[model samples]
Target chain A: MPQKHLVEIRDNPLFASIGAESFAALTRGAYVQNFPPHTELITEGEAADFLHIVSTGCVELFSIWQGRETSMSFQTENSTFILAATIKDLPYLMSARTITKSRVIMIPSQDIRGVFERDSMFAKSIVSELATCYRNAIKTAKNIKLRTSLERLANYILKLHLAQGGRIELELAVEKRRIASFLGMTPENLSRSFAGLKSHGVEMDGQVIKVVDAAKLEEFAHPNALIDG
Target chain B: MPQKHLVEIRDNPLFASIGAESFAALTRGAYVQNFPPHTELITEGEAADFLHIVSTGCVELFSIWQGRETSMSFQTENSTFILAATIKDLPYLMSARTITKSRVIMIPSQDIRGVFERDSMFAKSIVSELATCYRNAIKTAKNIKLRTSLERLANYILKLHLAQGGRIELELAVEKRRIASFLGMTPENLSRSFAGLKSHGVEMDGQVIKVVDAAKLEEFAHPNALIDG
Candidate 1:
């Protein structure tokens, strides 16, 4: 079963450009394993040996300094994490944990980096992936640098609303605390931010959020594709 | 003159991986020119056509939302900017300006992406550069998410101190207002932050800073190699 799953991942967009021989080498000893919630797959400042892909459920990437932690991002199904570390054979800067019971594929980083040199197409894909990741990180940085907590929350809810088919009302896809962490705010502050946004047309009742005026909220949030995307 | 400068850039660590032929292709029409301080070189949301390298002086990357702008980072000599945008052929998310009279090299992005596919070594160089940028951005994000303005200022001073041969007294390389923007704080808050760090062993008078007790300041800053590096 693990072998079958490994073979299938070759078609994953991340590996799509990988040649047959290189892909086989990368997946040779790859395995699918399931973990319970809160599983720590990788640790910060430690060498990462395996490149992880979430086959099901969510993986949270976070960092810590002086006993304080912050969520960097989340990877969903079919998404990969720690590729840059895997490619460079360096210690991971962030620790990754399972946000829910997760099925993850672990492929040896040695094999991956080794194959990087032997496969031209695979190398190109890595460049593209790295570029995309770099751009995405810049966008996230802008969210923190350019917006207030209230503006950040309003824009986030709008994104979720659009993603959920433009519904006026919607429940959060993740826990409020996790969302708060992801948005770079305290849970208490996030609660207050919700109240702050009430004047901006956002009403939060438990997990359900209703945007009374989407245009008004967007104008207040100034959701630019360059910053938010 | 442009040919001489282009040839020198081929020796930059960033282009070290490119084969002589590929490097020649990349620098075929490259030009190195000087710009005055505060000269805006690139704008957010505009298509990026050239990959810029700071040959001398400094280049500042900044972003704007609504009408407010925040400094993103500074690219010093030998460093490249807008690389991801150049490689992806996408619009830049941050605009760049010169902080001082600067010499910069501009290589057409078309030549870069075209050469990227044809040159294996150049491709590897790009993958490495992108990975570095990604990890560096993550570190910056952690700084914002985990530390207070005072902590950020202390750490920034410590880094400068270490870079300046562990001098007890140090001068900021850039204006405090620009540093404040880069650290996600206002000039007024930055002033307060500097004052706040006095108890933590930092003594600042205008642009001159002295770390009275490095250990005390380090303790307060809780400088983590993972984030600060």
Candidate 2:
């Protein structure tokens, strides 16, 4: 691995607190690779052999059932995928594919479990990281169950709006189709939802979204920290 | 806490492997209480002061947004609720209510974190428990996003049937309204979905559900371990 990639991987909170020895051991057999856009990195139902962290660009975590697929989440830079599966040594519950040409770090699950057992700091960090993941999943479920598709899309845009420092004009990171799937709607429904948001002062043109009135959008979305975060 | 409650709490996989001293420290400040049906145990967005364990009966973990409420999960005996929030000292994401007359054990969050720091085994157990929670949430997302109301109800009934040792006649412990909410459908939709399942050989009478044709139900439900587990 390059010095820069090592630094970026180390910056991840999951690896930040580990002892130097454990960190070295974790990275010893680890390898970094660049994936082309649309590359399938891992598939659901397969053994979680490697713990994957996106170094740059994007990776979409998705699932398929009865010939239908839906986007679970998208992992960008520094985001880890399937830590719970790697920790539990279970089958991957969601598949991963690179949405853009990306760099990713793959560490052996054995090394992860080995360090988790021998290093208390690493173990504690795993607890915190896993807790965060669990909470996020619960939040996702709540967002889906408690809100309509329009509300989901509205809050999703508000989330991106907030994430981008409340810019009046923001570009969506993921494609509309993937965003639609993540928000549990069809592409057609997403288009319709975006049209519906026009009344709330959101205007869209392809990938670019312009928040015409932030106050109106916020009032309409009612983005709650507990659900949105 | 009573000796029985202490033993049951210890039996939880999260606490099963901790040292006696750590276990004693955890239970020292803990207390067990019984709640009547429909009792609200914890509200969403409140500080997670206690790590709750359902010692007896059922507790429904649900969330409310605006005026709509949805069931997240129904935790039963030996199941822990909101461990991630308790460990992280964050607000509860979902409010829990007793669906049946219930006995619950409450362990203080401070003690949980204290013992977590001192006990490596306990920390590792927390990793496993949290991982399980995370994966369950993903499965739930897939179930909601990928399956329709009828499919969800079919699989849910199939799950209950399997849990009852493949019994031909299985009783739904929860009411139809709650099951409908949990499956992300309206009560009218739930009734319609149940009616839709009649072609697959299922019969419903109040809370009693009879799997008239197990083979047909399984073929229709197609319960996959990766998604259903």
Candidate 3:
């Protein structure tokens, strides 16, 4: 029987589609390791020698230029990170670090590359995952290009709310600073954006938020699934 | 014999690496057609039944939200667009339109999917291409999150200059307004950005641009291959 986390990972659609032999081949040498919060799992420009799966907690992908850093994305439980790097055997373009104490599965890159060549289903899974990743990224690029930070914050908060079945009250997922960076705005700008949105149906106290008027918020956000969802 | 554009596309490394039989199967029903500038080729929310490869001139991918539109990406010769949608059999999130009189080859989506499973080399090629696309999108996201519109414009101009082998003066590839959208800025901001860049060794005349001081421009742009390239 697989360990609890392993069982969860086995259920992941990204790897579940593979045959038993290929999945076994991939996980034969794979090991689960617990990491402390803020642990650096992979550094940008470093050789990618392993494929990492976040079995629990969260991991962030970020990049640095001229000593300035920006968070690119976050991956939570049961998702694989850096499949592209492992498949291409290329240097990681973004560094990944644990946002919280996390359990991660590490599969050697060689194992994956070897099995991918021999396993057609596994190859298809990789292709499908990559296709999804590519589409998500394009959508994100659209989100960044098409909307102002205010609109982005509204849609993001609305997305968060919807993900939890549209409860009126919710908690912010990441720190306001991180959220500000993720939305491509300054902390001050984010604060003002939130304040500007009060008339449009949002109320917040620290990290706690309330969607006082969902329809009004939606109207203000002008949310479009093509870009936001 | 392959037509002139087909000859060029046959040299495309994306398909060239696949086995000859897979390549032939892919191209058996592939046909290249030219369109007048501004022709809409692929509309968002439509079934992705064909994979489009740009053989000549230019095309842009863009999205609309509440009647507002922003350009997402531009594809030129020897490049494929909408691979993600075609591979995943999903609706396109972005619409594609010709920016110039362009030739594009359309391959029936079913043929590509059928060939992908049977031809491992072609499957690998698709994986590689998708991986590249994913990485590029991550880089683009980083660029948007990390830089201000002015910095982005400086880097954009430098990238254009370098792409043309560091030619002192290079014409803008797209209209200023469209370039502004692609860079996540307003046309007014782009004009002001050009004015700001004058101090950083950039000169502009209509669509014609001159990088008068290459080192100065590079210093300002801070071009990073991980993001800009």
Candidate 4:
């Protein structure tokens, strides 16, 4: 692997605490490649041969059943995917596709497991990283089960607002259709929901969302840290 | 803690591989207690002080929002809840309550982190257990997002049938309402879905379910290992 790519992967919390020798072993067989937008990277049920980290651009995790598909999540730079499957030696539960021209690093699963077995610090980091992933999944479940489409969209907007450092104007990174699927809504419903939010001081022109009044949005969204964070 | 309780909890994958000295440190401050049915053990947003293991009977992890409550999952003997929160020293994302008269073992979160830092074996086990949890949650998200209500019910019945060793007759351990909530459907929709499944070889007499034709149910359910396992 290139030195820059190794440094990029090392910056992740999962690899930040590892000793120099173990880190070298981890990236010894690792390789990086750039993918075109909308490229299929991996399919569900395939053996997780490599742990993938998004070095640049975007990767979307999705699942399909009986010709019906839903977006699970989106990954950006420095974020890893299929870590659990690679660690468990199981099939990938969700498929990964690039949403934009992206650079991704592929580390062999055996290398990850080897270091994990021999290095206690790497093992501890995996525990913390996996725990964080598990908690995030639970929160997604709670958000889907306990809220309506309107409430979900409102909360999502509030989340993006906070993520962008409480900016009054924000841009939607992904497309509308993927956002619709991620929020468990149809494209039509997402449009209607956006229209509905206008009454709460949200105005959108194309993909640019302008939050006119943060206080009004918060009052209506009721974004709870337990679920939103 | 009682010797029997210690034995029961040790059977969990999270603690099965720890050293004796680390295990002793883990259980030093642990204690056991019994909770009556419907008793709320911990509420969401509260600091996770103790890691809970169900020693006997049943406990249900659930969440509430805007007066609407949803069941996340049910735990029987030997299963733990809010583990991610305990490991992260964060607030409980979901509240837990007993579904029946249940005995639970409570271990301090600090002790778990303490042993985890000192024992690589325990850390490795934690990696495996947490990976299983994260994957399970992903499967659940796929099931909820990709399947319809009728399909969800059919697949759930097939899961129970397979879980009971292909038994012709199976039993529902939980009430219909909780099952409905867990499946992300209203009670009325649950009854209608059950009625719809009769054509597919599933017959229900109260909580007892009879899978008269396994092949027919599987054909309808179309259970995929990626989503159902």
What TM-score fits each model? Answer: 0.95, 0.99, 0.93, 0.99
Tens digit of per-residue lDDT, candidate 3, span A1-229: 2577657767987778878888778788898899998999999988899999998888988888888887778899888879999999988888999988999999999999999999888888899999998888888888887788899999998998899899999987678887787777889999999999999999999999899999999998988777776
Worst lDDT run of 10 residues, candidate 1 chain B, spans B1-10
- State the weakest 10-residue window (summed lDDT) of model 4 chain A: A1-10
List candidate 4 stretches off by more than 4 Å: none
Task: Give each model's whole-structure lDDT.
Answer: 0.88, 0.92, 0.87, 0.92
DockQ of each two-chain model? 0.85, 0.91, 0.74, 0.90
Select the stronger candidate by DockQ from 3 and 4: 4
Model 4 iRMSD vs. native: 0.7
B16: Cα error in model 1, Å:
1.2
The digit string of per-residue lDDT tens for model 4 on B78-169 reads 98877889889999999999999999999999999899888999888888989998999999888888999899999999999999899988
lDDT of 4 by residue, A57-107 (tens): 999999989899999999999899989999999999999999999999999
> Judged by lDDT, which candidate is best?
2
lDDT of 2 by residue, B89-171 (tens): 99999999999999999999999999998899999999999999998999998999899889999999999888989898988
Better of 2 and 3 by DockQ: 2
Using DockQ, rank the candidates from best to worst: 2, 4, 1, 3
Clashes of each: 0, 0, 0, 0
DockQ of 4: 0.90
lDDT of 1 by residue, B1-229 (tens): 4666865697677798788888888888788889999999999999999999999999999999888899999999889989999999999989999998999999999999989989888888888889999999988999988998888888999888888888998977679899999999999999999988889888987789998889898887878888887
Indicate whether candidate 1 or candidate 3 has the larger DockQ: 1
Interface RMSD of 3: 1.3
User: Residue by residue across B114-165, what tens digits does model 3's lDDT show?
Assistant: 8887888788889999999899888878878788899898998888888899
